[model samples]
Target: MGQEMYAMLNQDQRSIADTILASHRTQSTTTADSCFFIDGQGIYVMTVAWTGIAASLLPEGRTVHSRFKLPVPILKTSTSSIRPNNEAPMAPCYALNAVDILLRDIMNIDAPFGGKIMILGGDFRQVLPVIRLANRSELIAASLKSSNLWPYFKVIHLHQNMRTGPGEEEFSKSLIKLGNGELTSNEDDEIELPSSYVPTLCNRTILCPKNEHSLLVNEEALQRLPETEKTYTSVDEVECEDGDDITNYPTEVLNSRTPSGMPPHKLKLKIGAIVMLLRNLDVHQGLCNGI
Candidate 1:
């Protein structure tokens, strides 16, 4: 990781990173190219990278499932194929519990998470475990907060909103209140929006629920724009996985498929065209998703 990115970390993020570092000073693992970091007791500590994308970005990082080999729809009897790890953000409670069980067995310690110093970061208010056909009660039961290991962990509440831009302080505060159900509303439960935000709503952009719709709208808008369109085609490739033949799938076939959150293979653009990012390329430089 860049020193500048580390320097950009706010007080809350610094505290979390510091807590991870303080676990073991003997040695630390890091990837210079990755945008995130988690450090602990040298080679023994298991660091759960935020997502598969984040893991791919890191040199040593791996997803909780990949690192532990935890089964999909993990059960109470499930145990990790490997031993040891910590610092999992946005992991479901059941998943973490499976790790805890594995660690205790490997370390031969009768302690929570085999005496590992864990730092779990995430907002319970947002993106809880998605249990199909599950009710609200079942949803809450699946949360990390409801885990038996929850009491063993010392919770650190981060109050800082690091990504809030200039003049967005009030908007940020409102968001926090909204999440907490503390925002004031009228009898109809409608909170009035600020007049200053009207200009933002007026931007010449149409939100579409699917890629096909977005492509149609984009094409229409591009044709209407008074300029020559510049077409950019991605150098698409197909790298077959182990046990899979390369000839099984053709390049043209792969290019024709546009998965969610991915730009089309043949991207057309015009000057002054509005664009949004689908991935985090350089978070420090603000080239992230939805930029």
Candidate 2:
């Protein structure tokens, strides 16, 4: 971090950093397992984020999955790959539980994170774990508050809205209320935004619950555009176990598929149509995931 970055931090963030630094200094001087505190076992003060974009913005930050080597298709009994191992922001309860297990096993201490000081941060009102095909009950169950260890952790409240200005405070409060489900909803299960809020085309991005709904919106927008439409189709194929292109899965089947993390086989576009990048090609060049 540079002087400019330090100066950019709000009061709350600065306070958090100062506390972490003080703890790091104390841990560094201690004789008990100094290797784990000072060196390779893990960073004295590590930062973990749920998304790669958030991690990229932080100083020496890494996504939880990469930093912890979390297993794919993680289960109740799942463990990370690292031999030994944060401001773990927006961490799901399951992910935290996995780390708790890892720390206990590696440090040979039957305690939460081997009794190491952890500063967990996140907004429960925001997004939770993304479980495919999961219902509302399942989603709630996966949150950090639902975990048994949630009670052991001390909760600190930071009430100041350091980023919001005087005029914008009410709007910010309304947004918080909306997130917390405190706002009244209509028959459509939607709450009206703040009266002062204005939606602009350039600054707004529409989010849909399902991919098909998104595609529908895109098609409708494309039709309304006063320009010629262009259709591009990707080469569709199914590779067999023997490394041969097989006709067993027809082209229509492949073309009709719109699986998560995959682009549609047939891509449609028009002049002045908005689009989003799905993967990071070069962050330095402004080409990144979710851009």
Candidate 3:
């Protein structure tokens, strides 16, 4: 794991890792690389990244394992990492198949079941798999439901919302209805915003349809704040991996990118100011964008 990832872990997660590591070092057979056994306690703590998994399936990947003393390579699959994003289609089928083969051939598991334990988490309603240049059918096809592994999943529904504020059930139901596509107004299929959705002087937020609109609103709001403003400018650079520097991508080009994500070339804020996060940097930590 990267230092940043380790730093992001909460105390509970850190304690869990520490306890397990201590337990594995003394008595737990220490089956995995990160495992430790302590006296009579046995625990395995293997943390692998999606990119690492992809690298492991290569011929050279297996060679590295052979060179080292590996009892058996265990792989944990997270369906969230496989979901298609806006830029990519459904998870790479070849890579998935390779993993299945590795489980069967290397780990000695039956076909299809990748490892001894598979833990999957994420809400389907929140963000459907992205499929560009396609219709509803393609979008659905790119989702986990369309995969052969869907049948093995035992879907669990969470009914309670412990975080709900007073009278938030009604608001929650309204959102569910909107998500269900049950609130369309006419043939054009435009859903009317709630009466309270519009921005007001006393409202803490202004929900805009796009990031550009949001930026304008943010600037206006910041100016209205009764505090001294401080401006910070970002230094943009061309990278060999992320993008080619053949033309030395201009600062203007970088600034034109998504502000909701990729950091801005310049940022302005003030003490006691409010701002929205721009990405899912840490969900468990409640540090993701929009929160």
Give the winner by TM-score.
2
Residues 1-291, model 3: lDDT tens digits: 456655775655555445534433542222232212111023232222122232233223211122222222222232211111111112322333333455446556453533333223334555554444768886676565666655544443344444567867877777777866777687787777766544464355457999888878878888898998988887776667655663777878876776545555668889878766644354335443444
Taking all chains together, each candidate's TM-score versus the true structure is: 0.55, 0.69, 0.49
Task: Please state every model's RMSD to the true fold in angstroms.
Answer: 9.0, 6.3, 12.6
For model 2, how does the per-residue alpha-carbon lDDT over 43-96 read when each residue is reduced to its tens digit? 446666666676566556666777788876666677877711132324557787
Count the clashes in each prediction.
3, 0, 11
Per-residue lDDT over 1-291 for candidate 1, one digit per residue giving the tens place of the 0 to 100 score: 456776888888778667656554532222111122232213354545435544544445556776678886676577787722233435667887887788678878766666655555556555666667989998788777787876655555678776789998998888777878897899999987666756667555488998889889878888899988888888877665753766777788888988866888888888888887765465445454455
Model 3: residues with Cα > 4 Å off, grouped in runs: 1-108, 111-123, 132-134, 156-177, 192-211, 239-260, 278-285, 289-291
lDDT of each: 0.65, 0.66, 0.46
Clashing pairs in 2: none
Deviation in Å, model 2, residue 32 alpha carbon: 16
What's model 3's TM-score?
Answer: 0.49
